[model samples]
Target: MTSFSPGRLGLRAKFAVIAVAALLLGGVAVGYTLRSTPEPSTGPAVTSDGPERRTTGPGGPRLMVLSNGVRSSVALRDPAGPREVSSQRCERVYAAADTVACLAPAGALEGPKLLVSDRHARARESVRLTGIPNRLRVSASGRMVSWTVFVGGDSYAGSSFSTRTGILDTEGGLRLDTLEDFRITREGKPYRAADANYWGVTFAADDNRFYATLSTDGHRYLVEGDLAARTVRTLADNVECPSLSPDGDRIAFKQAVDGDPAKGWRPAVLDLATLETSRLAEHRSMDDQPVWLDDRTIAYALQRPDGVNDVWSVPADGSGAARLLVPQANSPAPVA
Candidate 1:
């Protein structure tokens, strides 16, 4: 295991990054071309130990998974006077409606533990995970919670990039650790492989149906998963990190460039009914699964020129230019 710094490196250093495992937003492999343009300064300074302030926004309540190296806190999105929901150190956080799920890794070398908490960050139910949890999401109705973790390996090792994507039925007390048991079909035929790994889950409003990224035998594909039948089938190739839209008819995902996973991906949206995909105007490698700000706009985290991660938004239909939404925020959960 080697150390990874998110700063820009020369060609020699980038080649080194490919060898040693690099951590992306969802704990996926990092192999994208760096964006050289400087991001415009818009919000307040991102301080790890800053005090809470109150600022107004359009949505109901803005949720941010913030950490100051030693401690992680869930704070409201107000930059002027942010409000604290909890003082727990979480690696990732997802909030929707009245449900907030926090992914916390127990020590420096321990596995992850997930806590389903209230809006005030009170733990209502908790569960231990089999791996290091990275991505967290809640269904539109807040009845379903899904998470993805790098299973059986550490983030620093090349072999540890394999993932286990899981879903928890909060109302039913049902938990599926991995989708490997789900019946799988590739190109409309039964495809079985022991190397299949799933990650980056995005759920629909119905809660029973969802989409995710499945990797097997050196290839990645966008998969449609059904909760009731416990089955999944590949929908398309070269798709990683599928995020369904607010209307449940479209999906925003990352498309691998030039059929190469290591070359990085472009953010795009797919109309589920039409099977049509349109690339957004971000024009940079996005490592995080995007969150829908509304039906028309989507937000995602990108490493700025200052090396810290910030939230940015673009039109879902690939029409408008990208704009900075929140500064120094890694995980953006817009509560409505």
Candidate 2:
């Protein structure tokens, strides 16, 4: 009788191989059942390092970007939604109902100007702001808004463009105060401005004090200016892009150590009293603006290597990692 070729398996061998495969698959299933980790417990509320300390509007807030210095924010019923808000071109601050601030050109700029807009990019007020007024700040009540109108066409702006910070009442009255050598606040604590290049003007929760970034002789610092006092004091050093907390106790800013605008920088937090500086996040890319969410978390605009700017958020306490809040964004503002 001819012998069976080695290439063909006998019935017994085939059965053995099948039996081994069955046993192996069964063992894998059993091992997976025994060794797999249990699913994490879900609860009514989850906590984290940052805003567990302050009152937050909604958990897992979503971001919306508009332009270089503008954004719109809305509630996140679901984080995975299409990022569609009920309104068109609203500012990012969502805490107050229908309250958001947009940065627009002040007017037909004979010189530099800042235009303040409502949540929907509608005109709120024009401050005749001159010089390079980049970032504008509005009060918690959204009543008062201010910004630095740098005057220097050249470098002498510290002396020449040294601006007179102005305040406007939506009801009617408009007042523009001269520089520090001469301030124009009738009362309210005697406020003074840092310098001409100083931008990022923001009002306090009480609508009393204002905060901003001042570039003096190329060194960047944070200043808390008292409108009533008519005086300005440097709060923190090596920092710019200052955004105050909703409560008005802490400040979120980007620190520039090299003192050169070309070198780039990182995001930081500073205690208003001690003037102590702490780094919240580092960026190989440019981090443009930061807005506070409940005084503990900061949301800002960041640009990646591919040149797509997006919104991002990280804890103020520096306990958590930097998370991308919006995948596509330019200037991100936190609402309410």
The best candidate by lDDT is 1
Q: Write the per-residue lDDT of candidate 2 for residues 202-226, one digit (tens) a residue.
A: 6777666777655554455576677
Model 1 vs. true fold: TM: 0.76
Per-residue C-alpha lDDT of model 1 across residues 48-118, encoded as one tens digit per residue: 22222223333345545443321222233443233332345667777777787878867777667888876
Error of 2 at 183 (Å): 5.9
Q: Which stretches of candidate 1 lie over 4 Å from their true place?
A: 1-63, 67-85, 108-110, 152-160
In angstroms, give how far residue 287 of model 2 lies from its true place: 3.8
The lDDT, on a scale of 0 to 1, for candidate 2 is 0.54
Supply the TM-score for candidate 2. 0.62
* lDDT (CA) per prediction: 0.72, 0.54
Clashing pairs in 1: 52-82, 53-80, 53-81, 53-82, 54-81
